[model samples]
Target: MTEISTLIVDGILAVLLVSVIVVCTIVYRRLGTIKSGQAELRALVDQLNTAVVDAQRSVANLKTSATEIEGRLQIEGKKASAIADELGLITEAGNNLADRIERGLSGATAAKKQQAPAETSASKKQQEEILAALREAR
Candidate 1:
């Protein structure tokens, strides 16, 4: 009977040892899975960081281009203003010349009308011919 009791105790110890080994194997497998996922998570974080850095550089480049464009626009605006002022002066000079020509023609017609009655017959005939020629030219 004592020998039988010793065998039963040994069997129980063997069962406990087997259970411990099975639990250890399950824990080791779970840890290996976690390690694999950790590597993938690290790679994803690195990719996100690289994308952020690239975006920052693009923003800086855009800012530089905008500043350059603004400077060019200001320069063009100044040039356009100067051209407009020059055109205004040219227009004023043309108007003044046209007025002078109009006044000169009117004065010449008035002088001719005042002298027509005092002219001799031959001179009056010559003046008429000249007037006719002026009309045709006009």
Candidate 2:
């Protein structure tokens, strides 16, 4: 009876050891899975950081380009304004010259109606003077 009891005790201990080894194996596999997942998470975080940095850099470059474009636009706008002003002055001068020419023609026509036909030399001289004035205005 004593020997049979000892054998039974040894058998129970062997079973318990086997169960403990199985539980340890399961825990180790789960730990390994968690470690792999953590490595993947770290890699994803690194990629995200790189993307953010690149985006920031791109935004800075865009801002610089916008500033340069804005400066160029302002310069072009000023040049356009100056050209418009010059054109306005030219137009105003042309209108004045046209008025002068119209008045001179009307005066010559009235003078021709008032003068005798023998005063043709005087009319020709007046026309020459008007032509010289027109040339000088140019």
| lDDT for 56 (candidate 1) | 100
- Give stretches of model 1 more than 4 Å off: 1-31, 109-138
For all predicted structures, in order, the TM-scores are 0.56, 0.61
Q: Each candidate's lDDT (Cα)?
A: 0.82, 0.88
Writing each residue's lDDT as its tens digit, candidate 1 over 74-109 gives 999999999999999987886676556556655765
Clashing pairs in 2: none
Collision count for each candidate, in order: 0, 0
Query: Top model by lDDT, which number?
Result: 2
Question: Please, what are the lDDT tens digits per residue for candidate 2 over residues 1-138?
Answer: 889999999999999999999999999999999999999999999999999999999999999999999999999999999999999999889868867886878687768768755666776778768766766766
